[model samples]
Target: MSASTPHRPVRADAERNVARILEAAKVVLAEDPTASLERIADEAGLARATVHRRFASRKALLEALVAQLNEQYLRALHEAKVDSAPPLIALHRVTELVMEIKFSHRLVMDVVTAGTPARWSYLSAEVRERAELLFARLHASGAITAAHPSWCLKIYLAILDEVHHLPAGAPELASCADEVTARTTLQVTTVLGALGGAPLPH
Candidate 1:
């Protein structure tokens, strides 16, 4: 069975177990790229056989994580109302939302990239297409002054990478909503500067 797509309806208990297993997998795999199902099960407080039953193999588990991340990425765009909000408001909101998601999932993302399944490639393309369209709108609205609208997309992505690579214990990443807000603000400001856009209004 493809972990990314379950065929049967999952019971509430099974759903809870699956959530636990995925959370544990992210923590374990993030710390050790080669972490095993056994280790993940231990982290989740479940038996090895239980995790095995939920996810047949490590690749399957990774696929499930990719699927979850894709959902969050798309949700971020939707919540930002990229198509309907004012161009600058949408840009700032989307950047902050995406940055938070990326920051939280940086560890899980490392393992998910070890192998790229077709589903992930397709979902990734969809995300990029949406981002490109958002950039085109930003360009037309004068929110970004890049020569080509595509350049804004490139620069925005590059800024996200830089934010992801920040020191693990950076103060901006402290476990508080205000810290996250600070980090996202810094990220949005950097992207605007890089793309030759004016600063966001206070």
Candidate 2:
């Protein structure tokens, strides 16, 4: 599950370096999923030995990346305020936050969700509950159908994935920034408009 909490004991400096490596890995690997750990070390401005000291092997590095991705995603889900906001409004905000995470951490997301029986889904309990409630709210508002409320929630996430179609061969990854936020919202709104009647007002 993408929302799994990580537990590891390390010195403060080593923890900071690990965090840096994971962040740099996101950008480097998003551009080239096959990028060498040497390249990641360069991006993080650290010695290759330093990265290897923290992560013994490429698989270990990737596992750390996935753990970091899960932490960031859980944070985003909590920050989305899905329960407190109005239905469509909440959905819009959630989509924006999610897209920001997805675009920035594209490679780690692919690693996590790559195979059959994907490791990623509505993994967080709070997120899943809030999503179902939001779907019910949207159904009541005629934004989604009356039947199969949970299915609607799944469809919402599926649509989000579909609309995030990255180009082939090492496209530059977008950061979780204001510009990317706006772009994701616009693109997703265009896609969801087809099903949910019209797009929500900007």
| Best candidate according to lDDT | 1
Clashes of 1: 0
**Ten-residue stretch with the least lDDT total in model 1:** 114-123
Per-residue lDDT tens digits of candidate 1, residues 1-97? Answer: 5874564456767999999999999899999999999999999999899999999999899889888888898898889888888878888888778
Per-residue C-alpha lDDT of model 2 across residues 110-188, encoded as one tens digit per residue: 7645532644452555556666776677667776444456676566666666656644222333444455565566554
| RMSD of each candidate relative to the true structure | 5.6, 7.7
Whole-model Cα lDDT per candidate? 0.79, 0.67
Separate clash counts for every candidate: 0, 0
- At residue 64, give the lDDT of candidate 1: 91
- What C-alpha lDDT, on a 0 to 100 scale, does residue 141 get in candidate 1? 81
